[model samples]
Target: MTAPFDDLRDESQQLDSLVAALTPEQWAAPTPAPRWTVAHQIAHLAWTDRAALLAMGDPEAFAAEVAKALAAPESFVDDGADEGAAQEPAALLARWRDGREELQEALRAAAASKAKFPWYGPPMSAASMATGRLMETWAHGEDVAEALGVERPPTGRLRHVARIGVRARDFAFAAHGLPAPDAEFRVELVGPGGELWAYGSEGAGQRVTGPALDFCLLVTQRAHRDDLAVRADGPDADRWLDIAQAFAGPPGRGRPPKGPRPGPAA
Candidate 1:
């Protein structure tokens, strides 16, 4: 079994590499996400990583705390108080880097001591937390890559993304106010490191297959599945292609340009 620390370390290194090469002007460039500058995207990431660190430190207690925090108005000034309010993007970036380091430390410490972490909903093992971070960083990294007009570098971290894609099916069903699909589907990906990331049978149908990174990008709505080389077989699989939500919170309507979805695979 691969260690959680390895995943977390790789993600941090990837993030650092990206940040290091960015010009100050590039940092301020507008991304595909409407009205969100690259700076804004990173700020959101920094905030999220910090939040994850806090939650990991106190999983059980933080579960209730997260509920209350979510209830409160989301404002740096209000939620983080004066010190956080004063920090600008550069400061936020510095703090974000720090948070990454802190999370690595937390993961290492947790592994040695057997610490548990709180997640958005369910309890997360320290290993899961690392995967969750890997998933988030890579997805968000796509946005950054888009802003810079660069193709994303491939990585083995995609396994985490595949898992998130499967989980998003639940979000998709819930968003449309429909009961969960009656069948499960297997998901396979063809990428730098092709693998059977996930397989479902019976309940939600069977078999979802394609490029690993493409599958992840498409499901997260970062890229259209049609735009990528991903292919999904089975009934529910086609339906899943219509909508997939990975992140938590309320469902996003996603991009405009409504048009006919491609017909089912032959």
Candidate 2:
């Protein structure tokens, strides 16, 4: 069986390859993320990758860093991105590549351990940590791809992202200080290869069904629920779509419906 880290590595390599060919002007292009350029997206990834490495190598040091971040949760992420964005494009790319390699090595080395790594939210096992990394990589990569006017091909790998989105339904509500729904919702996504990936009970009253790519975009806040092909069958599921955040953080104000989605590349 392939470990989540294997998928993480593949996602990282795909994003790296995509960015490596970008021109300097393209790197500076504004992404879908408000106030964040392509550089900021990559820089943020690099910063988190370094933090993940620290968490793996030295828990005490990582805890200290986490404490500092907790002191200013709102600004910590942006501040780190600003620092990373100051680097020249080459330097930034190198830093991200090195950090990613280090993180992968650490995860592999710790595969046998049952230790939980502390994060902004709950601590995570190595497998969950890797899945989170994969989700982040794909989410941010969408921003960069959009800035370049490149259409990212949807893949079966999006199963990881959809799973996270389903799992985060309650987290999304809780992050906004709202009470979580009492019942779980079934999530059914059609993979790029036409496979059905279903989660939760088939008979659940609340359910979300959609194309995998649209679900991913919605969960990542790259596209508004209104713009996606997804459908929520119940009130709770509908509310979840209004604020479905896969990444750990405050509740995100999802993208507003900005005209119809563009057609696929001819």
Candidate 3:
């Protein structure tokens, strides 16, 4: 398997390729994310990569930025995206490409040193950071793809996203002001190649089962849980499906179901 940093680079490159040929008009096209354009999506990625770089290379500066974010928690992310989106498309694209490349190099070095960096939550080693970056890249790329009317086939990299989602089970509950469940829940997902990726003990009574794509989309808040094929076995597991989120923040206003709820897999 490729290193996590390599995987992150590949994910960023994939997103870069998607936008490399887009016209300025296409860059301006609005996405499913309320009021955000395709350019805003890429800009957000660039801003985050730079923020990660700051956290790694200069903690003091990163701390100051964190304070700013905390001061305006609701608008910080959008404010950063808006600032970058105001740039010309070509300039914004160049900025994103350069920033991601720099961050990828930093990640490789940190991985070798076994260094940990600050995050919104706990500190993260390079591998964990890379996995997180990969998740956000794929999630935001989905918005850009939707805006452009493009289809992105699932890849093995989604396993990283899935693992994060599965691991974040407790965090998801906490984010929604619910107590974390005590019993371990088994999660089994069908990967893109039809392989079963299972987590937790098979003996566990509570379980979540479905296509990996749906699970990943659910955890990322890119798709509503009701619209997905993912299902939960026990009441706790079912409640979990209602508010799973891979990313950190106050609960998001998630996208509505695609149509009438297909309901969970049974």
Candidate 4:
């Protein structure tokens, strides 16, 4: 099995390569994320990377920081982004690159399986933190890619994302103050390389099936569930599709369908 830390590094490098080629005007272009430009997306990632490093290195300080953010929930994330986005494009890029390196080193220095790291949502194991970072990188990369009108090719790394999406089914429901469904659903995805990845029992009454890319897109709120070729069987499975979120946070309002639902991107 691939380590989440390795996947996190790969995802970051992919996004970094994309951003490295962007012009100043392109860096300032708006993304699908509300009121956030390409610079804002990278800035947010950089900020989170710094916070993750703090959580790994100083639990008390990280806890205090989380408390401060939670106290002003509505503006905490936005305020951080706004502040970071004010930097010049060169500064923003260098900050992100440095933060990414620092975070990877911190995660590697610890015993990933046993060490717990503080986060905005809850304490997480190093492995989970790495996975969450990978998810965030990919999701934000989508925003950056869209802003540049460039379509990124799907990769097997999405399996990490899909696994998180499946695992977060209950969290998704609970985050919205809804009771988690009692049923266990089977998830089967066709990977970018045409390999099959299955989670849960095949005979499970509830099932979600689709291209892995689309599933990741839906879970990350990068694309509306309706826009993907994903299908859910059973009421609980269907509801999971409506609220699936891979990244930690409040329940996200996913994209609305644009015209008739389109097929999954190649």
Candidate 5:
């Protein structure tokens, strides 16, 4: 299996390619994410990359950063993006690039360690952190691509995102202040390569089934569940689709259905 660190590097580079050639005006163009422009998307990713670095390399500093976030849960993320977005486009891009590289190295160096690191939620290993980073890059890159009126075809890396989404069923419920269903829910996703990726037991009573891309999009909150092909067989399963979120943090204010508008190109 390819390392999650490698997958993260590939995903980050893909997002970087989309922005590397963008003009300053293009960088300032608004994305599908409300009040956040293309620059803001990239800046947010860059800021997060830096945070991940701190979490892995300097636990004390990361805890201080966490305190800041707790003090301003609603605005802290926006504040980071806004601060980074204030920089010149070139400089912001450089910071993102450098930050991701540093994070990549941190993950790589700790790949053999079983130690868990602090995070907004529970602690995670190096590989889990890398997977989370990949998911974030892909989700934010979706925003940047839509802003540029371009499409990024789903890649095999989406498997990583799908896996996280499937595993986050409980987190989804908890994020909404609801308890998770006691019974496991079966998830069967059709990957970009047309292979089946299954989670939970085959005999599970509740189930979610769909194209992997749509599932990832729905889980990431990049697309509304109503707009996706995902299906749920039970009441709890149906609710999971509504509340699914792959990334950690507070419950997201998910995107509404695009209502008659064409989505990103194929």
Candidate 6:
């Protein structure tokens, strides 16, 4: 648990370092996400951190305030409803950095030993939030990389991504209004650490396996499943792949990568 938060702090710092290295032109580069520049991705991550901070401090109030703000008709015009709508890029970056630091401070100050917050689905403990933060940082980091056409160095935080992939397996299946397969799937990551992860079993459900980084990328929709070495076993594996969702929201069909390809195995 401590490792998850520590990893979150580390990832945030890394993201800052990565952003700082970008030239002005690079900052404005277009990403795979239509209408979003690299700066926009960073701003979004900052915004999400702010949301997580509010949720940690006061879940009920946070939910209420967010609902009130987003309920406005004019909210959509803010371009993804960015809180720092009128700010310059530098100002937005500063706000994002400051907000991330504030979130870290708040997370540290709270009683980490016994705290749980309502997430999009599960009641996430402090540890889960830390892992969630890691997942987000890495995912958004990918957005920056895709924009710049540079590869990022995958690290231990990938385990967080892998964990999210497992959790999203059920969501992936249910996205199409289909019953999730009732079986257990053993997932193995052929990493330097030889990581062993699993979800439902073969008789219980489908199994997903491959390099940890690919698993994360597949679930995040950052990389097409076919481009990666991920392997799914069991009868239902292929079915699960079509609808996996990592982010919280109503079931969404992410745009296929630039071309047609096979999705995760059911």
Per-candidate Cα lDDT values, in order, are 0.69, 0.87, 0.91, 0.88, 0.92, 0.72
What local lDDT score does residue 62 receive in model 4, on the 0 to 100 scale?
Answer: 91
**Candidate 5: regions farther than 4 A off:** 260-266
Top model by lDDT, which number?
5
Error of 3 at 26 (Å): 0.3
Superposition error at 223 for model 2 (Å): 0.6
**Residue-level lDDT for 136 in candidate 5:** 94
Number of clashing residue pairs, candidate 3: 0
C-alpha TM-scores of all predictions: 0.80, 0.94, 0.95, 0.94, 0.96, 0.84
Q: Please tell me which model should have the higher lDDT, number 1 or number 6.
A: 6
> For residues 1-266, could you state the per-residue lDDT of candidate 2 as single tens digits?
24688889999998898899778888888988878888999999999988888887788999998888879887888898888877889999999999999888888877788989988777887877888899999999998889888898987778888888888888899998999999988889999999899999988999899999999999989898777899999998998888889988776657879887589999
Candidate 4 accuracy as TM-score? 0.94
Q: Who wins the TM-score comparison? A: 5
Give stretches of model 4 more than 4 Å off.
261-266
Q: Work out candidate 6's RMSD over C-alphas.
A: 4.9
Candidate 4 per-residue lDDT over residues 100-151, each given as its tens digit: 9988887877743577877877688877888889999999999999999888
Q: Which 10-residue span in candidate 3 carries the lowest summed lDDT? A: 1-10
Once model 1 is optimally superposed onto the true structure by TM-score, how far is the C-alpha of residue 168 displaced, in angstroms? 4.2
RMSD of each: 5.2, 2.5, 3.3, 2.9, 2.6, 4.9
Candidate 5 positional error at 133, Å: 0.2
Cα RMSD for predicted model 3: 3.3
Cα lDDT tens digits for candidate 5, 1-266:
24798899999999889999999999999998889999999999999989988888899999999999989989999999999999999999999999999888888888888989999887999999999989999999999999999988999999889999988889989989999999998899999999998999999998999999999999999998878899999999998888889888899999998777677999
For model 6 the TM-score comes to 0.84
